[model samples]
Target chain A: MSQVLVVTSGKGGVGKTTTTAALGAAIAVTGQTVVVVDFDVGLRNLDLVMGAERRVVYDLINVVQGIAKLPQALIRDKRIDTLSLLPASQTRDKDALTDDGVARVIKELRAKFDWVICDSPAGIERGATLAMRYADAAIIVTNPEVSSVRDSDRIVGLLDSKTKKAELGERIEKHILITRFDAARAARGEMLNIKDVLDILSLPLLGIIPESEEVLRASNLGTPVTLNDPTSAPARAYCDAACRLLGQDLPMVIPNDRKSIFEKLLGRRAA
Target chain B: MSVLGLFRLRGTAPVARERLHILLSHERSNRGRPDLLAILRDEILAVVAKHVSVDHDQVHVTMDRGQIVSRLEINVELQHPANGPIAAEREKAAMTIVHQASR
Candidate 1:
């Protein structure tokens, strides 16, 4: 069965779009059919990151409002045959994405792809909520910083209270992906280490994308880091994250709080 | 990197962690907390009242984040009526268990 996942961070520029493209490409390289849908309306850039910008004849808004067919709107990757993208409309506002429209598109995507990843716009607004509304799992993109971690905590709150799974009384699987992690800075106590971020977010550690210029170069070249330089640290991290998403067993940066005995012993607490 | 910083006590990360701990705990406690806490206390008191009489003011429901976990600690102070049989014994027994353990 296919899984719908959302890459979200309560704060912008923490790499939701980058993660969406890299993870999707990495999964597709493993021969799994993956489609990354950009939900950041009026700022659609997943196609750019995936190098499918010029091929976009239609967009998510077009498919949702019946302006175009789903096939007509989805842009297939030039490099990876199994990878595709459902680009958001740069001309439309956040209000263009309706709940029912998103649900229909997600259901259709689910039937066709092995993985459907949505790149949520920042903050807990209509755009962000709609992006995560239909997700079976969430990749909480975060950076090792105070503001970013705090925003992620707020997103966790919304994920627990506002999503479809929460409304149905089912828990949506959540994973924390800490990106741009600088080990040297952390050692110097300038940046928050992986442990500090995980302790506060208290979610399963997906993978840590270390600070690297390769990511920036890949985006500038209109390619995902995993495809541009597969052996690089950031690329390897993204690939590991994709594998973990596919149920591969791997060691993490540290002990994640989801498995912490402290939580197990404490049981459920007052919300 | 000062002398105090060498001891790992002055990093901004620690400060941020401390601030987040306080903020999240406060925010968590307020997640439907005011009425929810009252309802939980009343419901728990009602259950205990079925087996043993408990005063409405005797039940306390709290949500806290210790170093270990986010906890919903419930403390029901079971006190015997002053005139009841073995009331003195029950009073002595009550002090044995703090709010840390629950049956």
Candidate 2:
């Protein structure tokens, strides 16, 4: 059975697109056919992140507006044959994405793809709502901060009340993926701990992607961190999250910022 | 500061949880479930008043959210009119109306 999952966070700059690309790539690596749809109209970046920016000619708007067919707009990744990218139009306005058009495209995508991962734009506007309109499950990307957590809560409320399943009285599956988590800072009481976020959001923890420069490097290189450096901390965490999405019972391991024994000994001696 | 005070440094976590809980509760009340308790109380009172005399303030309606099913508690006091088991009949009638209204 195919499933549509939306990676959404009400606040911007919380790594929703990054999470979508990583998870989509990781899942595709497991031999599952996956397509990541960029739902951020007018500010299309999924194609760039997927390294398919130059390859995108006809986009989601073209398909929705009947200017191009679904197959014509779909960009299949050469690196991973099973993975595809449905890029959004960078020049089109957000109003171009109509409800009926989105429903048609999503229905078609679900017929061919095993996992349709929609990367939602920041905010609770028409674009974001349409992205999540047909989702069977939601991965809420949140940072370990007050404003991010608060906005995530609002999105959770909307998911419970606004989604198609919600309107039909069926519960929509929700998971929390905390992005840019700095364990060292949290240990030093500078940032909120994992437990603090969980307490506020009250959703099952999918995975914690640690704050790392590798994520930026991977994006700049036009490759998802999972495909670029699978051994990196963020990549491993995202892979683990993808496994969890497939119903695997994996223990969440929060990566620690490595400190040498010499530093530990020096601190102890000073104490 | 005392050593205990160091451990008890108030964080924004608890505050966030409290604020979210209050906000969500208000939203649910406004959009989801209506004031069913008040309506049930009025309906039960109207049903019981026909059988036996009762005060307007005699009916009490409360809701307790439990682990399994949320329980709705209703209480009604009946004034005896030279009592010939009229209180019991009125109670049964009120209970029937309440059960029907709930469904």
User: Model 2 chain B — which ten-residue stretch has the worst lDDT?
Assistant: B92-101
Cα lDDT tens digits, model 1, A1-271, are 9999999999999999999999999999989999999999999889899888888899999998989989999888989999999999999999988999999999999999999999999989999999999999999999998889889988998998889999999999999999998877788777888888888878989999888878899999999988997867788888888889888998764311122466567884211
Model 2 per-residue lDDT tens digits across residues B1-103: 7898798776555655565555544444444566554576677667777777766576666665422234566667665556564555443222422222222
Report lDDT per candidate: 0.83, 0.85
Clashing pairs in 2: none
Off by over 4 Å in 1: A253-271, B1-10, B32-103
Q: Evaluate candidate 2 and give its CAPRI docking class based on DockQ.
A: incorrect
Model 2 chain A worst lDDT run, 10 consecutive residues: A262-271
- Could you give the C-alpha RMSD of every candidate to the true structure, in order shown? 13.9, 11.0
Please name the candidate that would achieve the greatest DockQ relative to the true structure.
Answer: 1
TM-score versus the correct structure, for each prediction? 0.75, 0.73
Could you give me the TM-score of model 2 versus the true structure? 0.73
